[model samples]
Target chain A: MKKLLLLLAIAAFCMPTWSADTKNLKYVDGTTLTIINKPQHDGNRLRRINTDKYPDLTSRVRHYLNMPTGMALRFRTNSPVIRAKWTTLDTLRHTNMASISEKGLDLYIKQDGKWLWAGFGNPKFEGTKHASTMINDMDTTMKECMLYLPTFMQVNSIEIGVAPDSRIESCGDIKRAPVVAMGSSYTHGSGTSRAGMAWPAQLSRMLGVDIANYGTSGQQKMEQFFADIICDTDADMFIFDCFSNPSPKEIHERFAPFVKKIRSKHPSTPLVFLETVDREWKNFDLKKRKFENDKEQAAREEIAKVIANDPNIYFFEPGLYTGTDHETSVDGTHPGDMGYQRAAINIAEKINATPALKKIIDAAKAKDCCKSPCKCPASKK
Target chain B: MKKLLLLLAIAAFCMPTWSADTKNLKYVDGTTLTIINKPQHDGNRLRRINTDKYPDLTSRVRHYLNMPTGMALRFRTNSPVIRAKWTTLDTLRHTNMASISEKGLDLYIKQDGKWLWAGFGNPKFEGTKHASTMINDMDTTMKECMLYLPTFMQVNSIEIGVAPDSRIESCGDIKRAPVVAMGSSYTHGSGTSRAGMAWPAQLSRMLGVDIANYGTSGQQKMEQFFADIICDTDADMFIFDCFSNPSPKEIHERFAPFVKKIRSKHPSTPLVFLETVDREWKNFDLKKRKFENDKEQAAREEIAKVIANDPNIYFFEPGLYTGTDHETSVDGTHPGDMGYQRAAINIAEKINATPALKKIIDAAKAKDCCKSPCKCPASKK
Candidate 1:
């Protein structure tokens, strides 16, 4: 008996000294928190088009089913790892989109005050299923972090996990009012390498604000459906880049109603309008060149009349997409990563320069998300 | 017979006016052509690490097998469409890379003096047989264009196709000198959304130059084998971003020798050395902070000595990555698309400003590849 006890003691001595302690984990609803690109929705069935009133159109307008395209959540955590549990309704069919789209959750954190991308929690399957993903090797001391929700998937609920003992809290200071973008496939993130490279996503990163992407591919005709949905949706700012999908007649007819309807609902919110980029072969193709020029002229005239009395509306006469060179687009129509980057920088600069939008930006800065000494180069710059 | 003729005539008349013409199909040895990232060798066996001498290390060094990490081709075609046929030796297991990386070809064209993203020639698989990939709808009038090679596959040979009447010519005035990048996975394009988003590819687009990405994933130990290979490889400029993989001790021991060897061989060739970015969570973790600072200091000291007397060599201290906020990285180590963009812009700007590089760039611009009225926003800007 004594010998057996001695053997047991020896076995115990050979074991590892430290133990992995499971702390009390906490769950936070992404919807209840400040999600960057998510609009105020009735549950996770967030709609860019009013699906409740136009239930018949839900199946036709597939984009409305897609979750907030570039939405992200900023948080503080002291865990060595971040685990997420989610219920995703749909996954993209395109191999490109499926690879980097909203089927996964992309994680970022404030490192030196700038948002640095960690890794993503890739999904395991394609449909509505309870799946979990995680970033396992995180620095335990990490405090400030951000989580980008799926770009093309409808997330029913998301639960973020830290060490049981560690806590996950909402980023209180960074209050992001929705910045709504209404446009065609370019705004819908068609050619982007990932959801985050969309112009709206880039603009959000630059401006440190939330964006609600209301991009409906091939369907941005400034139709009554979009106007009705966008006007009713709560937004701080509205940007229109739908010239690609609308014809001269449609622009002349429907553009004003869309703008006026939004103005009627949110009289105080800022509205920004942009003309389409000059076609890729505009110089070589005279017909295309003429079409592009005429379209811009018509768009400018329409926007001018809509904002004539409204001081809150701003019309930017199409110079922001200057980098639409040979490297900017993925297809003739949709902007790729570089195109998105250029457009975002151009648009963000214009928005920053606008008096009303600039005021909101200044107010956001005053919120002071990072109150402590910032070592981030962005802050220093 | 008359009724049959009538039916055939009806079918022909009803058919679409435009037909996909696969003529003037030329199988130019991609190696002989101005393939950007590929180093000239005995046929398509172009390698960054001289596999002949280090045959034992070939299998161990995985990234050396990755073809066209940043390889691109600049050409002019009026085919209205572009198709490619390649024999890819290896396909990445990762769905993202396999889907978009080596299995695809990214095409861009010179428009208004800037490179524009045209579209990709997506591969069509035929049970391991060499199948063709194509971009069906390009402007037949497109005079100048560029093509980026695969990132993760060893392309044995490639065949470029055009319309029978249209011709494919070299980018006549746009002579591209090789810009060689030596580093780890970041240079190998681990987290980039697409191959073109890699820093080397971006730099090539920005400068209108060829790039040879010799980015070895985790084998940047300043080994004699790599030094020998890099020394012999022809390059106009050399950029070293291998800091992520090398340890502090390795930096202290091998950094100077590596730089010195390259300097000895190509004394006039510009060498750019970089310090690593500040670790994402360095402030939060004291140990990590110390390690990062120490590693950077060691690397700086090594580079400083080598560049002290060499006016041709430029040492860039780490300040390029400012958006490290939480969005710049894929994991704690690799940079994602945004990070790559930030790094590329910084490096490109520095290379542009360097006296030696600026002269070369000026000379390339003087070549006047476009030779047309520049309307591209990049040129205008």
Candidate 2:
């Protein structure tokens, strides 16, 4: 008994103190938390679109809806360490993308009125289930935090974990309206290194506004269903990154009708169209160069006709999205982290310059402070 | 007999025009080519270090020597499409790095007196044997080109493929003395997206100088053998990225002697010691923060002592290698492509500022023309 007791004592000493203590951590449903950069869904916090309501949508669109591309959980916590336990729909891996950008979470902390990259939940390669400590050894002061969801992979379930003695609570609903963005892989964060480094996510941080990403990775062909989804959503503005994936014929056939569908519901809302980024490989590939040029030409013609009648419609021409050097892409198509960051900066500058869009962005920036009327301690500073 | 002959004619018509035509292409051994950015090896063009003379070197050092890192084949071709057939020693893949950076090749073409990214030989995932058409369908114009070798994997054999009618010839030897860089994975191009995007590779392109990469990843522990290799190599400048991998104790024990070994042979050569990059993750992880801090402190102390004694010795303090945003890394430890680019620019700036280094770099810039006395057509521009 004495020998056994000695061995047990030794074992207790060797074990990490936090292992047993972590059991005392409180668990909360992700649905109860404040979600940013997502359209209102039917109680499914993990999903970007309400699948039941959009049952008639294509299988690919329905599948991509569960990815939560620009969605994030907004909360306030005094926890020294932030942990996450989540299950991914598929442990997806891309040769050009970092694993963290595909299936892991990115944590940002609001420090001195700015959201800074604090930590990342690096997912494992073999399994769908993942558990990671996002950040640790932080001071136990109440901090406003945002945890960006995986850009490429869907999440089945997720639970934010904190220390036993700490508290985590929702930041409540954001009063400012979101800018709904619909597009293909460029907007879907394909080549970006981290989940939050996606262009839309970067824009949200830059403009201090919510931008709901409806990117479906080569599926944003300006279908009637996508237009219907965009029209149904309550948003301050709409941006289309719809030219890159679809055939030029598809653009000519669907462009006018797609705009009409959205304008029917919210006629005066700011509608922005992004010109397709010229692929770097097209510089050498003659066939691809012609193909991409035709698609852009078609998009420009369609946009010109639509904008002639619509007062609030705006067009953003391609402006050095990846710089003049043409070295920013991973696969000569989709933008990498540097490209995304550059695109976001250029796009944000365009948005800020437009009078109608700038008003909404400024309003959103004002509301980003705690409780609109500026009650938070940070506002005083 | 007529029917058989007709069938053969149809088969010949169906086959690609280049298939049989490529048989006429001249195969040149890599050693005979103008192999830039590599130290003198015992007739082995692919290796960074000559293992025959250094028989007592560590197995890891011997293995890492096979990776080409910053080496490139300088040649000129008028071929519309560039193709490559190569066999890798290992079909290495990292989740964070793009496949093209590890085992594939990157091609850059000189345009209007500047080297522009033209194409890449993207490696397949499953096999060691790889073949790829890097670029296609360009106007037949004589273009000066450089093909960067793989950063991580070893190349067993490689062949450059061109049009049957076109000629590929070496640019002759670079007249300027090369910069020999020694270090760990950062110098080895771990997190960079492409082989040519490695800092040393980028530096070469930026400064128009040959910077020989002697980065041996985790094995760069201030080994005496590495010091001996540095002493033996004919270089104008020597840079050590040797602080990142070694333990503080190992650094304290070996750093002074390592510098001494190099100084013994080439006392006047500009020897630069780089301070390790501050990893972004260390912001939250106190333990790692402390560990890295201690290592940097140790390196600084050792570097200070060496600099005090030797007038030619220089120490470069860590700058913002990955920018202030802290979102530039693929993993928090290794810098991504953007980080590498930033570091290269900063390091190049520091090198350019030093009068002793500036003289060597200016000489290199002058020699980058077709012939030493400004004979190239571009020099007139």
Candidate 3:
């Protein structure tokens, strides 16, 4: 009996076995999905921020507050699951910040024409502090997926992993003129659950275009440093949604100057100036109500002064944050997911109908916006 | 001159270093924040689902699906940032899955009596597959915070790290018997940007109590295996919100039996049976409308049959999802943060008002549920 059992065990061992086929697995950079807002940089850092002249790091907040925000990638793959390896330069932990998946990789896949939750990569903290780490084993059977990078951490680089035999591909070239939005935490995705659920991200999904988010938390003060960067950035359109961050005095002093700086660089690019989302509780609180209303009027006058001479500039009408109430905010300052969605749909409609923006979209379509220009569909047609 | 320069650099490094005071930093296990619904296990794994009798791991979804869903902890810390280290057992990868902050440690802190964004621990994926990782340097100045575990991955164990000099304390004791919730994806926190944003988590925060989330995605069938596990769980209340996953036929056939099983174990425990959240599109789509209506009727009927004789069980009133619309969900089935909050507030009010439930809360208040019996505040009071 023992000899027979041994023979059976040997036979089982000799039989061919199936593993994940990892040997055939290949790593793809997934760059085609529009690594939005990230400019080319030397060294290991991938920065959406143009921090060439950022102020000295005074506190830990300074170290973490200026990493990439609203930067993400979309792609398609046949792998049942996706794995990744990357590292962040800063580690800023807060209970709410950490709980919301900030500074970590988040994924959503299109399933049956709707985006579904698949899973997320885990952060293993070991090895050299300066180098990258691996977050493995996300489960999904979908062929296409969108990845939102960490909103608060600067990643050195990222490498997408799949089964050795699986195929990986990026979402191709930026199909439309990218939408560049600069603002405060509202644009930076404060109350939304994940980076992809932010207003700009939702607009990107709705329009099937790339929307680069340059929203910084508590830092969108119409600084010359940011204006200089915007002048140098490449975008078919620009949206300034910083009414919530700066005071009325600062708006009067700096709004026109910033617009002029950008106009000097890209005179014909379409620009959209958004007034602040209304405070729902203003009717009940007289003091707070007056403060917000006063800011709104000042912003309106400043935007009017800046766009009066620029034919390409338009103001996004107020009431975009309709259906909002006290519950729409995380803490009466940041819009929750519901409020974020309202803003996204409103902006998507405004941008979709604007004639100046239409021209940019139409031109990109006519030219086929193809990275491989030799194989341009418009030329072939 | 070169030697002198080196000497100066060394002196600079050695003279009264102003770091976070490493010697004062201490590592504490955050498991005290109500590791609810998890059965005592001898290994490092922290599992909320009844995996002891779980079905075969035929698909990647099944493997990742059965891991922790809403298992989290709450504590107070004076540390500017809270950090953690953990290891996951299986590394399942998918684009949508990897893009989420799943299987990752997330943190939230209380600021001005509201939870605010702090930061998150970065996972380092290197070295042996089964080893610990250190997610360091979360920036904070808050003295109190809450931490949520990964939604998808099975963590072996976790160690919370703080500045060497900072003190770490669990939330003293659960103020009430932890609310143990069992259901489908909604209970699992689908569409929530972070684990703590799930409906149950929201309830926990709202009531200042502990909640153990045992929400399984696509696996909330009322099988005897699961019923057996629930019989053993320790909770102040049991909320069954699995109407979306089971068919009317299953409700008629198995619902009463499952309730009876729990009643057999704890006759007086408060039980709340909830119908599924109304499908937002049902009002507009005929087929979906019928399907949802049928489920609602079946659940109502089943609850009636089970609660006919039992005074402890109560049917959760309809309209828990009253303020919701299609936009409140990621997909039609799962609630986003808005939907989740609406449900949480509604349910919290109902539970707070229920006579049977209030008895449980009152009793708990009278006898403190502190971790260390010697430190029991109720006795002292």
Instruction: Tell me, by TM-score, which candidate is best.
Output: 2
Q: Estimated TM-score per prediction?
A: 0.76, 0.87, 0.55
**Ten contiguous residues with the weakest lDDT in model 3 chain B:** B127-136
Of the two candidates 1 and 3, the one with more favorable lDDT, higher being better, is: 1
- lDDT agreement with native, every candidate: 0.61, 0.78, 0.59
Worst 10 residues of 3 chain A by lDDT: A127-136
Q: What tier of docking accuracy does candidate 2 attain?
A: acceptable
Instruction: Provide i-RMS per model in Å.
Output: 5.2, 1.9, 12.9
DockQ for model 3? Answer: 0.06
Candidates 1 and 2, the one with greater lDDT: 2
lDDT of 2 by residue, B1-381 (tens): 997687446434433234324455655555445677877655467877667778878877887887777888777766766788888887355756777787888888876567788888878765798888788765565677788998888888888888777666665543223688888988888877778887888888888777889888778899899888888899888888999999999999999999888888998888988888778777555556768999999998898898998888888887326667776777667887888888888898998889998898887666664422224333110
Query: Tens-digit lDDT track for model 3 on B351-376?
Result: 78887786765565444333332242
Q: Cα miss at A298, model 1 (Å)? A: 3.9
lDDT of 2 by residue, A156-219 (tens): 8888888776777776643234688889998898877778988888888888777888889989
Which number leads on DockQ?
2
Clashes of each: 26, 0, 46
The best-first sequence of candidates by DockQ reads 2, 1, 3
DockQ of each: 0.15, 0.37, 0.06
